[model samples]
Structure formats: C-alpha cells, structure tokens
Target: MPQQELFNNIYQTHYDKVHRLCKGYFNGHEGMAADATQEIFLKVWQHLDGFRGEAKLSTWLYRIAVNTCLLQLRKPATTKEIKTEQLPDVVAEEYNPVTDERLKKMYGCIQQLDETGKMIILMVLEGVEYSAIAEVVGSTEETLRVRIHRIKKQLSTCVQL
Candidate 1:
C-alpha cells in the first residue's frame, strides 16, 4: 500500500483510542492531547514505511503515543497549563471504565503517586492489559497486579473524600 493510504488507515483505526490515551496523559487537557496526537501521526506518517510487523499495530501506535506524551510532559508548562479554551458542549455523559467518572480526581490523585505507580495505574485506566502494561512499564505481571490493586484502592479513597 502507498504510504499515505497506509497512514490514513492507521490513523483512522487508532485515532480515537490514541486521542483518548493522550487526553488521559494530559489529565484531560484536550489541547495538549490534540497537539501531541497530531505530532504522533506525523511521526507515524514519516515512519510507517519501515514497520516490521513484529509487533501488533496497536502496540506500535501506543509506543509512539506514550513516548509523545512523555515528551510533552517534560516540557516547561506541563499538561496543566495547556488548557482548552472551551469545554465541550456535553448535554450529558456517563463514565465508563475508560471514561471514569472520577477521572479528574483520579488523575489528580495519580499525580501524587511515584512515577512507577503512576505509570502502572495510568495503563490500567487506559484498559491496557496487565501483561502489556508490565511489558511497557518493565515490571512483572504479578507486581503490576499488586500495584494496580493498591493504586485503585488509594485513588478510590482519595476520590471519596
């Protein structure tokens, strides 16, 4: 397939999830996520021709997204400063596992965690599997399970009060 078509396919397939992933990383800072998402796709477009088929496409896209988010976090203002000019005109919305009702509080609580804990729980919130999260975060599956359990309890308590 041509590079443009391949990129278009990948973007269409991954955009919503990728955008959500970036949004989560930015603590619901939609503008920052929007910028990072664009940068991620640009990188994907530039590099798609060399994809080796060794990893799942989603995995590859996520790797790019996580890296992009991490890079964005390293910048001066941080995700907190890059707020959206306006909120979405939501008539109403329900929070699912992915869109946790407590997401803002959760993210705030997550900010208080150590880097490793934050990574673990962030992946869990994103609904990434324990095994994949372990691979990405460089921990054992058992270790992640323990960490996630603790993290969830901690966030729940924090959110409740």
Candidate 2:
C-alpha cells in the first residue's frame, strides 16, 4: 500500500486502541487523549519509512504510543487539565460507573504507578495479549507475568484504600 493509504488503514485498525491507551495514561482526559493520538499518528507519518517489520506493526505503534504519551505527560504546560464532560459514545466503557468517584480513585492509583507498570497495566486493561505486552516492555513473558501478578496485587491494595 502507498504510505498514505497504509497510514489510513493503520489508523482505522488501531485508533481506538491507541486512543484508549493514551486516555488511560492521561487519567481519562478526553481532549488530551485526542491530542496525543493526533500527535502519535503525526509521528508515525513522519517516521513511516523507518519501520522495518522487525516487530508486528501494532507493537511498533504501541512502542511509539508509550513514548508519545510519556512525553505528553512530561510537558509542564500540558499539566493544565481541561476536563470536558463530552465523553465519546464510542468509548462509553471508558467512562464507566455513571458516577465517577470510584473511577477517579482508580485513575489516581493507575497514575501513581511507575511508567512501565502503568503501561503494562493499561495495555492489559485494553486486552492486549501478554506476549505482545512483554515484547513492548522488553521483558520475558514469564517476567511480565510475575510483574502483572504483583501489579494487580498492588492495584487492588491501592484501589481499596
């Protein structure tokens, strides 16, 4: 496929997943999610020629996403939280519980996790397979599994507090 066509197809295939991950990183701030998603795709476009197929395309996109979202979070100006109430119907599950008190606590717990832990948990939450996640995090599957177990234990403790 031509690069533009390839990008469109890739965007269609992965936009929701990428957006969901970005939103998770941003604590469900939809605007930031949208902005980060755009920035991610823009970077992908700029660097499309560099993809050498050493990994699955999704894995590459996710690696870029992890880095991009982390960069967005690191920007001091981006700390201004502009929360709006317009949750996209497509991502309705993302804004669960009608009342958001519990959800906020969970996001807070997630945000407090170290970067790799945060990526692992968020990708797991998005239903990414364990092997794929391990690839993205550059860990053995067995090690990722152990970290997942520990992360879950930590999250449960954090959430219940």
Candidate 3:
C-alpha cells in the first residue's frame, strides 16, 4: 500500500480515540488536543517508512501520541487548565449525559493519580485488552490484574468520599 493510504487508514481508525486520549492528557484542552493530534499524524507520516511491525500499529501510534502530548506538556505555556465549558461548542448532541457524567467523574479521580497509574487506567478505560495493556505498561498480566483491582477499589472508595 502507498504511504498515503497507510496514513489514511491509521488516521481514520485511531483519530477519535487518540483525540480523546489527548484531551485527557491536556485536561480537556481542545486546542491542545487538536494541535497534538496533528503532530501525532505528522509523526506517523514521517515515521511510517520505518515501522517494522514489531508491535501492534495502534500501540505504536499511541506511543507516539502519548510522547507528543507529554512533550507539549513539558512546555510551561501549555500547563494552564482550560475550562471545558468554555470550549467551542461542537456537535455534542450525541454525547450521552450519563456517560459524560461518569467520564467527568472518572477523569476527576484520574487527575489525582500519578503518571504511571494514570496511564494504566487510561489504557484500561479506553478498552484496550488487559493483555494489550500489559504490553503497553510493561508488566505481567497477573500483576496488571492485581493493580487494576486495587485501582478500582481505590476509585470506588474515593468516589464515595
């Protein structure tokens, strides 16, 4: 396949998920997420020639997107919290109220997590399989299972508090 076709396939497949992930990392900064998403695609375009397929393509794209967002985060100017309500109102009629509320609460709790904890939970929340999460996080499935259990218990208690 041509590089453009490959890039288009990846972009179409992962854009929404990657955008949400970027939004989480940016704490709902739509502008930042948009910028990061573009940069991620750029990186993917540049690096596509060298992709040897050692890992799943989604994993590789996520690795790039995460790193890109983190790098943007390293800049002091990018650290301010943008109010989600103040964001440009796009077509959100499709957003389910209950799911949005849950996601907001979940992200609120997630903000308290340390980086590694946040990454693990984000992958899990994104519906990445436990086994795939283990690969992304570099731990055994057994260890991940225990950690996820503890994390959920902690969230349950914290939410109730």
Candidate 4:
C-alpha cells in the first residue's frame, strides 16, 4: 500500500486514542491536546518511511504522541495576553472536564505522578494493551503491572477526597 493510504488508515484508526492520551497528559485541556495531536501526526508523516516493523504500529504512534506532548509541556509558555474584553472561547465552550471537581482532582493527581507513571496510566486509560504500553514506555510487562497497581492505589487515595 502507498504511504499516504497507510497513514490515512493509521490516523483514522488511532487519532481519537492519541488525542485522549495527549489530553490526559494535559489534564484534559482540549486545545493543547489538539495541538499535540497535530504535532504528532506531522512527525509521523515526516518519519513514516523510517518506521521499522519491530513494534506494533499503534505502539510506535503512541511513543511519538507521548514525546510530543512532553516536549510541548517542557517548552516555556510563549502565549501572549490578548486585550480582548471577552473571555476566551475555551472558557465559553462550557463542556470542559475541569467543570467536574472529581475529574479535576483526578487529572491533578495524574499530573502529579512521575513521567513514566503518567505515560503508563494515560496509555492504559486509552485501552492500549498492556504489552503495547509496556513496549512504548520501555518497561517489562511485570514491572508495568506492578507500577500500575501502585499508581491506582495512589490515585484512589488522592481522588477519594
């Protein structure tokens, strides 16, 4: 199959999952997630020819998504204030996750986790197989399981508040 066709198939199959993973990293900021998702695909398109078949395609795509989000998060904020009298559209959208206290606490707890824990839990929430997640995060399956159990324990105590 042609690269374009293959990429389309991959994007269609995985876009929502990748977007959700990015959103998780950002504690559900839609605009940031959308930006990271776009950056991830651009990288994928640029490097598509270089993808070796050693890992599952979804696993590889997820690795790119995670890295892109981390890079975006690490960059110093370049946003400037607009002197508009109106609130931002993101605020007006009214469907944000932060609207729910429980969920907001959950995202806060996730953000407080170590980088690997955040990546692991985000991928797990995306319903990526444990094996695939383990591969992307570079942990053995058994170690991943143990880490997940510990993360769940930690998050539960935090979120129950």
lDDT (C-alpha, whole model) for all candidates: 0.77, 0.91, 0.79, 0.88
| Native-referenced Cα lDDT, model 2 | 0.91
Q: Which residue ranges in model 3 land beyond 4 Å of their true spot? A: 78-102
Candidate 2 Cα misplacement greater than 4 A, ranges:
78-99
Q: Tens-digit lDDT track for model 2 on 12-56?
A: 999999999998999888778999999999999999999999998
| Residue pairs in collision within model 3 | none
Which candidate would rank higher by TM-score, 2 or 3? 2
Model 1, runs deviating above 4 Å: 78-89, 93-101
Clashes of each: 0, 0, 0, 0
Per-prediction TM-score to the true structure, in the order listed: 0.76, 0.87, 0.82, 0.88
Residue 140, candidate 3: Cα error in Å is 1.4
The better candidate by TM-score, 1 or 3, is 3
For candidate 3, the per-residue lDDT at 133 reads 74
TM-score of 4: 0.88
Ranking, TM-score, top scorer first: 4, 2, 3, 1
Clashes of 1: 0
lDDT (C-alpha) at residue 61 in model 3: 83
| TM-score between candidate 1 and the true structure | 0.76
